[model samples]
Target: MTKREIDEVSGVETTGHEWDGIKELNNPMPRWWLWTFYATIVWAAGYTIAYPAWPMISSATSGVLGFSSRGDLKAEMTAAETAKQDYAQTIAAKSADEILADDQLREFATAAGAAAFKVNCIQCHGSGAEGSAGFPNLNDDDWLWGGSADAIYHTIAHGIRFEGDPDTRYSEMPAFGDMLSKDEIRQVSSYVASLTGNSTDEQAAAAGKQVFADNCASCHGDDGTGDREFGAPNLADAIWLYGSSEAEIARQVRTPRHGMMPAWSARLGDTTVKELAVYVHSLGGGE
Candidate 1:
């Protein structure tokens, strides 16, 4: 038979339609490819039966094994808690001071305190305890409350400015607005500025001495040296809480400034609070 005739008579036919003088073959899919397509369908059917593959209006189909992603997380947490129990039990038996001495307990406390500080103290104390405008530096020697280990522990246990905790440290810088005249406040501010070697109007500072004697002497001492028990900051030292500017001082005298540090005892738990105290104490300037 001739080649053209043979092609025409072959059972594998050509598409009846042609485009641009070219005809397409009407070919069956490869046997292997067909088998693969069928296998995919069968696998999908099995998967749908075994797992949560279908979605409903308000819920998804529960798999036969009743597996859940949340269950995996809970299992992981349970294991971690089990591991932590030993350390927790050991810490519970020791005092904060003893924990500081023990290498393992100290390491654990440091880690725990750092985590809690990031969560709680960082907002006011800064990530590195650098402190902000009103907040005191945990890294510095100047402590409103004493810097001893016990002192820090006490402060953390009972937060300053916390309402309903009568034992919580409390101090109020009386506003000069009702008590001292604006001129007197300005003078006192100038005198406060002078304590830090910050430039002040000489006349204002002169007038401020009288104002200091009358209003600020009780808590700040006659020379602005400050009272530790009262938490009154020393104006003589360069450490300015609200800022050393004449305006800031004047504003403080006129409308006073009160800063409250949140107590961390309950939030950080006892061991962590102790660790934070130790960490702050270790900071170079800590008293």
Candidate 2:
């Protein structure tokens, strides 16, 4: 056994271990630091015993205090739902128009509706309600059906071209590809495009005017303004569900693509549907 050596310069004990020419000092840690380290170990042990810490194969050990984050969250959610019960009940009983007429109910419905829209309608209507191709933009004034609160509620409750619902808003534009000659389809396309100041062919548009007046004027007004009762789209508007280009217009003239919106009332219920109508009606374009 080798005896520990003392440093000649400081007269302190050496660890008796050396690397090269350097010797290590046998310096003990400060009493405060050592005590703190021991205290932390004790605290960690206490914490483990008092709270959930150990994991098992199927579950974790429930500590003595019986605290659970999931339980806390469930309690909070229950409290929130309980508080909203009255408001939800009132909404269920009231019509969308009646709800909109009340300022407080309208405010609540709009906020709730906005939340629902993100979950249900955002895929087609977009996050900001700006529609994509084949979908109608909700923020714009142009509505194929109608834009009023009642109208919007009815449409949302029943849906557009939804075959499942007997009361669904339904309209069918005859596919002109089967009905008209190719040249006649092109002429009518030029006329329709001309309504929106998008046509280039003057003679074709001229000939197409008669074609439109004869075939399209019955559903779409003589001036190309839409008929809300028939759910016909206004041809003169800048907003187009498909596209406004000549090729797109020609394609629609040949074979119109009718978009379908699901009847949300059947799936989401009346209260949520009313809220959705209120939210959509508040989107600046609602009449």
Candidate 3:
């Protein structure tokens, strides 16, 4: 039957004689939709020929234009490298001290170093370099190693307190657990606290003074002031490595705490390391 007549007719076709008032229409596919489907097939064939659309055993087919995602990425990387070359040249030519002197260059280095710190150093040093219980605060002037440009650079290039590193800085604070009794530890901690003028029990502080004279006088001096050459922290100052809590101090005296700050020179490059040191030094604690 003609298309229009087929649409108007009721019960045009049925599988068998219907028992209820339900029947199926004798439908044909829409001609417009059929034409569009044919068009899609043709378009797909054209697209397959012009683009890398087909898969092979080992790789995909190359398109007529020879376009590649890898090639695009390579071009982008090359452009980025070219842009960075000028900055890199400036960094290489300038000395760390010179960079520190130039406000503009120092600013650039600061920005660059900040980015590097976020990725590499911030985890241990903290975002502000204030440090945690074990870690040393970069914002403070107290450096176990040295804070000079060369010293900072060297430290970054070669890590300290790390295993398997031949040149790694090595020093172990002897654990007093086996040597000193609990009362002695508490006394020593109180003495250490008194040196810094922190609140402490007078009796405990007095007892700790004798322990300090016997055990800690050589490195820490008679007054509990530190010897920088030995990397001993000054007990006279308010700065505490682990913390100032009485409990924290007592624990340290009993067990000792050794924290390691990673070196960044090799990983961040000399210029970046210098910039980071300068930035850290300027953070209200540079001596």
Candidate 4:
């Protein structure tokens, strides 16, 4: 049997380990440190039994506490749905004017309308409602069929030139290519462009003024002011749906492009359509 060695310097025992001429001291860990290490082991064991810890083949082992993250999420979602239902019921029972009159209802309707617009309208009207070449910007006060709340509501509910809805707003600009010569078309195009100061040829525009009076003044008023009854847009305004350039104007003169919007009454129902109208009106554009 190998006898344990004791250090000669302080009379402490050696650990029977040696590297070259050096010996390791048999020092015991402090009581506090030992207790802490033991406590950690006990905590870890208790935690494993109280919470989910083990991995199984198909699923994890549920701990004794029986808590589930999915259940908590479902409870939260149910509460939100219940709250939303209350507001939805109230909106369904009220008219557009009545809802607007009540501050609480109007706020709820505006938020709901904004949400619907993001889902259904961002494709055409743009994310910020700025609009593109063919689409009309919802952010602006310039409106073709009038910007009144009732008018906007009607347009949204029934749509514009949509074949699916019989009550859809309808207007047709006759293609002048069928009746007028190419030069005449350019002349008329310049006249229309000149209304908004977008014309390139002054002489042509002067000559086209007569052409507009003879051919186009019926729908678009004599001074180029649009009639809302005819769904005609104001040619005098700089807000051109297609474009403000002479070439674009000439193209439109030759073959007028009609814009269309689908009726939402059937698809979205009355409540949502009213909400959408309120939201669009509150964008600082509705009259």
Candidate 5:
């Protein structure tokens, strides 16, 4: 064994290790640091004995404490559900309108509805309830059916054009592609476009007035304002389920695109439906 060398400048003993003529000093670890290191080792050993730490072939070692994160999470979830029981029961007992009358209950319903909307409705209606191309935007005043709380509740409970639910709000716009000529379809589309904004073809709009009265007036109303009773969308409003373009109008006049919503009440339960209705009503446009 080689004898230890003393560092020249510091007068401290040098470690046997050296690199590029630079010798390492064999300084002792600080008392605090050494204690901390030993404490960590002790803690590790105690932790292994008290809580799960070692991994075996098929399973991990269950420690003496027998504590599980899963058990803790389950207990917390049960506590939360129990706390909501009163509010849930009260919501079930009250109609959406009745719940609105009670400030406390209404608040609870709105929060609950928001949670439900995030989980279920966000996929189609969007996270902000703004809606996609085919879906109806819930934030706006324009409604294909009606916007009242009761009406909204009815739609949520039964759904729109949902085949699964017999009482689903149903409306069918007869596809005029087979019945009407291309020119007639274009003419009517131009007229419909002229209702809300300036029509691209003024001459077509002028000529299409008679075509609209003859074919579309009964369902869309003579002025193209729409009839909610028939679930006809208002052509007068800029808010459109499909689009506002003349070409989009022509396409709708020819083929028509129908949208469907699932009956949420059957899936989420009546209380949740009421909460959703109350929450949706509070969004902005509900009557």
Candidate 6:
């Protein structure tokens, strides 16, 4: 057996573990630290007994306290829902315009609607409400139906061209391919593009002016500016719901794609629909 070594320099006992003439000191922990360590062990044992610590086959062992984080969360959620009941009821009773007129209610509805929009509308409108190829950008001033808070509410509540809702905003552009020759469609497309200074062919645009005046002037106006009552989009605007390219415009002229929006009132109810309208109107484009 190897005897433990003592360092002569400081009279401290060595652990007899030596390498390269370096000896380890055999020092006991301080009394306070030892007591603290013992206390922690006792505390840990108590904690395991009082809290959920054991694993089982299908579930975990319930502690003596019978406390669960999920249960607590459920209780908290119920409390939060209860607290919002009054606001929800108030929103249900009031009109969208009335809700927007009130600053406090508007603020609340906007916040709530923003949350709802993230969950429901984000998939189609994008996270920032910047629309894609076919979707209408909500941040811009261009509106097919209208941009007013009331108008937006009506559109969102009832939807656009939604067959399920009898009151949905409905409009259908005639497929010019069936009515006009291919050259005429091209000429009209160029003219429509020329309304926004996007046309390349001046002669074609000139020829299309008469065609537009004859067929499209009633709904789209003489100057190519849209009539909102008919949900006709302005041909003069830079914002294009589908695309602005000459080919794209020609395609739309040949065969128009009518987009459909589901009536949210049937699914989300009137209060939430109003809230959504208020929120959408506040996106900096509302009239």
* All candidates: CA RMSD (Å): 6.4, 3.8, 6.6, 4.4, 4.1, 3.6
Candidate 2 lDDT score relative to the true structure: 0.91
Model 5 score (lDDT): 0.90
Model 3: per-residue Cα lDDT over 1-287, one tens digit each: 53332223564554333447555565567999999999999999988888788999999988888888888999999998886666657866876666677787777767777777788877887998888777777787676667765556556656767664566665667888899988888888888887767746999989888998998888878987777667677778878878886678888877887866565655666667776765665666654
Task: Flag the better candidate by TM-score, 1 or 2.
Answer: 2
Provide TM-scores for the models.
Answer: 0.66, 0.77, 0.65, 0.76, 0.75, 0.82
> Which one wins by TM-score: 1 or 6?
6
Residue 85 lDDT in model 2?
78
Q: How would the candidate models be sorted by lDDT, starting from the highest? A: 2, 6, 5, 4, 1, 3
Residue 163 of model 5 has an lDDT of 92
Task: Report every candidate's CA lDDT.
Answer: 0.78, 0.91, 0.74, 0.89, 0.90, 0.90
The residue-by-residue lDDT of candidate 5 on 185-259, one tens digit each, is 988899889998758899999889999999999998999999999998788988988889998888888998898
Supply the global lDDT for candidate 4.
Answer: 0.89
**Per-residue lDDT over 141-170 for candidate 6, one digit per residue giving the tens place of the 0 to 100 score:** 999888888899899989989989999999
Off by over 4 Å in 6: 1-5, 15-23, 38-75
lDDT of 1 by residue, 181-206 (tens): 77777888898898778855988888
Off by over 4 Å in 4: 1-68
Q: How many clashing residue pairs appear in each of the predictions shown?
A: 2, 0, 5, 0, 0, 0
In angstroms, give how far residue 74 of model 2 lies from its true place.
2.7
Best by TM-score: 6
Predicted structure with the largest lDDT when compared to the true one: 2
Q: Predictions ranked by TM-score, top down? A: 6, 2, 4, 5, 1, 3
